[model samples]
Target: QGLRRAAKVQAGQKVLVIGAGGGVGTFAVQLAKAFGADVTGVCSTKKTDLVRSIGADDVIDYTREDFADRPRRYDLILDIAGGRSLSHLRRALDPRGTLVIVGSERGGRWAQGVDRALRAAMLSPFVSQKLRMLVSTENEEDLQLLGKLIEGGKITPVVDRTFSLSEVPEAIEYLRGGHACGKVVITE
Candidate 1:
C-alpha cells in the first residue's frame, strides 16, 4: 500500500528500496517489480545477490558505496532502514519524486522514531518533492489482493531463520541484532 497508495508508483518509474534485504525490504523489492517499476535496492554486501535474485534491477552495497553519490535518481524511494536523514535521502530522489518513509528504529523514547515522520510532514509543503511517512493499516481487500499475489507466484517470501515457540526470546534477540536477511519466524 505504501508503494501503490502513498508513493503512487507507476510502471516504468525508477524505484529505490533502502534496506532491501531485510524483512520488509525483501517484499518491497519483489512488489516493486510486480508493479512494473524499475527497482534499485540498497543493502549490505552480503545481501546484494539476494536482492538481485529477488528482481532488483540494480543493487547497491551500502557498506562500500553511497547511493546518494550516484547520478541516478529515483521516482519513488521507499526508506525502510530508517537510519539516514531526510536531507540525505532527498539527494537520491528526483526533484518531483516521492519519498515514503516506512518505519524507523532510531529516535528518542518520547517519539520512538516517529520524529522523522513528523518532521517530514512539517517540511512537505515547503519542498517540491512529496516527503511522506507511511502509516499502513490492514484491510481485508488489501489482504485478499496480497493473497492472490502470493498464490499466483508474483511474490515469494524469504525466511532467513525460524525458531521454536519456546525460543521467542532468542528470536527477538536475533532480530535486534539486525543480521537477519529476511523474516525471522517463530513456529510451534
Candidate 2:
C-alpha cells in the first residue's frame, strides 16, 4: 500500500534506490524498471555492474561520494539502509517526493531499524513530503505477483550466499559482518 500510494509512479519518473545491491534493493531496482521508471541504483563499487544487470538505468558508487550531495533530484527516494539522516535524504527529494524507509537494519546484535521507522512516523505529520515507514506483511497475492514478475523476467532475486538450515547461527553472523553483497539465505 505504501509503495503504490507514495510512488504513484508514472511511466517516466526517476527513482533512486539506495543500497540497490541488497536483498530488497535488487527487487526494488527491477520493480522500478518494470513500473516504467528510470531507476538509478546506488551501491558500493563492487556491486555496480550487478545493479545495472538487474535493470537499473544508472548505478552510483556510494563508497566514492555522497549521493545526497548531488544537485540532481528524484521523484522518489527509497532508502533501504537508513544510513543517511532524514535531513540529508530530503535534500535529494523533489518538492513533493515520496520517501520510503525500507528495512534499515544495520545488522546490530540488537535491532536498529525499528527506531528509525518510529522516528519517521512521528516526524511525517508535519512534513509536506510523504515520509513513510514500510511495514511489510506476508500476503499470498503479493507473493504471487512477485513470482509472476520473476517468471516474466521483469524481476530477479540475487542471493549472495546460502547456508544450510542447521547453520543458521553462522548465517546470522555472516550477515552481521555486512560484507555480503546480497542476501544470505538458509536453505533446507
TM-score of each: 0.97, 0.89
Q: Candidate 1 lDDT (Cα, whole model)?
A: 0.92
lDDT of each: 0.92, 0.81
Per-residue accuracy of model 2 over 65-162 as CA lDDT, tens digit each: 78788888898899886678788888998878888888755543445556666676788889887778787778788788788999998887789999
Model 2 lDDT-worst window of ten: 104-113
The segments of candidate 1 whose C-alpha lies over 4 angstroms from its true place after superposition are none
Model 1 Cα lDDT, one tens digit per residue, 1-188 = 88988998899999999999999999999999998999999999999999999999999999999999999999999999887889999999999999999976665566887888889888999999999999999889878977888999999999999999999999999999887998999999
Which model scores highest in lDDT?
1
